[model samples]
Target: MSTDTLDLDDGTADRALLDARGLTLLVFTSQGCPNCRQAREALPDMNLNVDRIAWVDAGRSGGLVARYEVFHLPAMFVIRDGVYYGAVQASLAHWDISRQVALALDGYPAELP
Candidate 1:
């Protein structure tokens, strides 16, 4: 997948994780990762209707990792009103990435999974 990575040291602002007017979804993935591939495929079908931005870095870029407080690869972060809402993984049998986005838009707090 194509990625748009933000350069943190250039003094540019990190993309707001949440937007008060609407909600956003940020799915962190890496090349050559299988689980990330499955998540990406299932994202559209899930309840989360979000503007997806794919981050290419998998911890090698400190700026990118710290930008989102990412602790691991193949992770997900959902945001609402510029605040973090949720995260999902392939291991979550009951988890659907899109549901997190939908729930956030429906007035749920930022609930990280």
Candidate 2:
């Protein structure tokens, strides 16, 4: 399925996640991070099952960084129907990301941060 990508901040990110009807990949990134830039370029073309990819600028989203416990640049989380599925632990490769997302969804949902 086609996925939409949004560049969101703290408040907007929170609203977008809460309003999302399908699976949403919430990614935390920073401006100077090379991995983050690669993610921005690669995510749209990746064959992921998510309906939307919500990007939160870690430099600007202190609240979200703190909430999600983001210590790295390109930290990802899976959210389905407004419930948190947990962090997505995968490489930047499309296949790895898709596989990890599927595996993450198989587990029980976590409390939204």
Candidate 3:
């Protein structure tokens, strides 16, 4: 992983995602961040509707990181219909994030909910 900081908010960063007409979960991460690496890796296993964006713009990554309070390297959230479900961290699990998505859509109100 690149030990480089990231820059979000740029038109060039790869907008890789699974998007729809509704709710989205924004995962803020950098390749150097182990946690971020995990989340990005596990994404393919979770059944979700999402629009994933990689913030490679090193200039604005810090501000975006602070705005989301993403003090950790790897982070995730449960966005429902379209709202902040909060972020969390875990070592690594195949179903951990999938479960979060389940609970979120099922009205779990999120961890912050």
Candidate 4:
């Protein structure tokens, strides 16, 4: 199934998260980052078990960047039913991303930052 993606900024991220249902892939990305571009391209086709993909431009979303402690481009976090799960640690490969997301969801939900 095709997953929906919402472009978010610091002002809108929280509201989007609050409104999100099911699994949400919250990603911090930069426009100039090559890896971020690749992530943008790969994520839509990854077939992730997520209801939506929330894209936050790190360069412009200072609040979210600091809150999430994003240290690199294309940082990904998993959220379910408006609760924060944890960061997703995986390569850009579809299978790897899917595997990592599953592993992260199995862990306890983290306190939102």
lDDT by residue for model 2 over 59-99, one digit each (tens)?
Answer: 99899999999989899999999899989889999889998
lDDT of each: 0.50, 0.90, 0.47, 0.89
Instruction: For candidate 3, write residues 38-66 as lDDT tens digits.
Output: 66666544544444323332234665555
Which 10 consecutive residues of model 3 have the lowest summed lDDT? 12-21
Reference-based TM-score, model 4: 0.95
lDDT of 3: 0.47
Expressed as tens digits, the lDDT of each residue in 10-90 for candidate 1 is 132244332233445565666577876775565544543454443444535556556657776666665655666655443
lDDT of 3 at 91: 44
Off by over 4 Å in 2: none
**How well does model 4 score by local distance difference test?**
0.89
Per-model TM-score on C-alpha atoms: 0.53, 0.95, 0.53, 0.95
After best superposition, candidate 1 residue 83: deviation in angstroms? 2.6
**In model 4, what is the error at residue 58, expressed in angstroms?**
0.2
lDDT of model 2, residue 13: 75
